[model samples]
Target chain A: MTNWQEDIVLDCSGLNCPLPVLKTKKIMDGLDSGQVLKMISTDPGSVNDVAAWAKRTGNELLETVADAGEYTHFLKKRH
Target chain B: MVETAGKKKRMALIASKGTLDWAYPPFILASTGAAMEMEVGVFFTFYGLTLLKKEISPKVSPHSNPAMPMKMPFGPDGFQQIEWPIPNILTGNMPGFETVATSLMKQTFQKKGVATIEELRDICIESDVRLIGCQMTMDVFGFSKDDFIDEVDIGGAATFLEFAAEADIQMFI
Candidate 1:
């Protein structure tokens, strides 16, 4: 776990594929290095989509939790 | 691309069909872009006009692509991964797979409270997102000037190309 595992929260509930990922990208672009973004989404594809964006955009997925059918993806932008 | 308060993104939605799957990327991007206040436009060509047609636009489905997608037994919207010979069709005139996918999306968005086709068109209009109907394609497809929604601006390939080229961000979906 990284230090950023506890900081930003982006609740993208009711959003579907691509929007969540696209919104995640926008957030990551705004934050500084080491800042974290926690994305809350109801889209089932977000797990794969966020992971793919992280891999492609050089961000890091610190952790992921799925509870009560909601998915929360934790990501730390790589410097 | 025209400048906005935040970031400016120029997107080119090459809407080729009116299928639900095909309709999505454009609508999502347009709505999301406008929601973010970005200047966006979608150029509808071929069968994509159904998105604006009031009489039967809601009923529009694929007349070609067989591999169009919808919700699956255990996955999300348009997330199912299957391959076909073409993006919107396989081998015949049958709507086949794309129908299921598009229909499901309509249902999903309705459930999720996103705008309907008409509402989306209104949003695009109010948001200043350009909705251009392909003039050449319309001619090629035998669509008259009266065949489109009132919001669409008719333009030929040269016009669209010029407009698309001037955009800071462009995408052909």
Candidate 2:
């Protein structure tokens, strides 16, 4: 998958559920519309939680790549 | 996409337990719901009102909780995976067993990167999730508003019901 240019990179490695999503929302709130964020998390639950959060909050989830136990997600801030 | 009928989704939660295990769900859901753009309110009633206290220290009690698996938080993966089947007699009669259990559970949560209850509550406050303490409970328990965190609003059942009435999801946790 093509890597989208990210305005900020959030490393949530070793953090569990809700923290990753909460921190992601915090940073996303500070970004301009259409800006992309790259979030890396080691929590397995985030694979689904981040997608669900982006969907519910109307953010754009560009891509998610899972390598070993780590998951990398690219999300775009919605207007 | 615009909300259906242009109404924002709302979630109302009634927290009635004060144990360490019981405390996580309400705060976790409240914070997550707020992050999802939903208005969230958690009503702390009965023992749950203790959670709103400024110095919140919830502990796990293994006495009656037979299903709670006891595991060492600090160990190799294989060692950590082994669940020690603690006898009910020992857990029930042993002094300081509850404290040990609470610390072990906390250590496990920390090792697995779970957020503390305080952290989750802070996030909820930051996200504008309403933290409502039951007025009747405080009066019954002889607690003052000063006992709780400043971010919490002290209210009666009616206040929570008003929000829960308009909420899309309501849970008694």
Say which candidate scores most in DockQ. 2
Give me the runs in candidate 2 sitting further than 4 Å from their true place: B1-5
Clash pairs, candidate 2, are none
Predicted structure 1, TM vs. truth: 0.53
- In angstroms, give how far residue B59 of model 1 lies from its true place: 5.4
Error of 1 at A63 (Å): 16
Look at candidate 1 and tell me the lDDT of residue B46: 74
- Pairs that collide in candidate 1 are B10-B169, B65-B88, B65-B89, B68-B98, B69-B101, B70-B101
RMSD list, candidates in order: 7.9, 1.2
Docking category of candidate 1: incorrect
Looking only at chain A, give the TM-score of model 1 against the true structure.
0.90
Candidate 2 per-residue lDDT, tens place, A1-79, comes to 7958999999999999889999998999999999999999998899899999988888899999999999999999988
Output per-candidate TM-scores for chain A, rounded to 2 decimals: 0.90, 0.97
- Residue A73 in candidate 1 has what lDDT? 90
Model 2's CAPRI class? Answer: medium
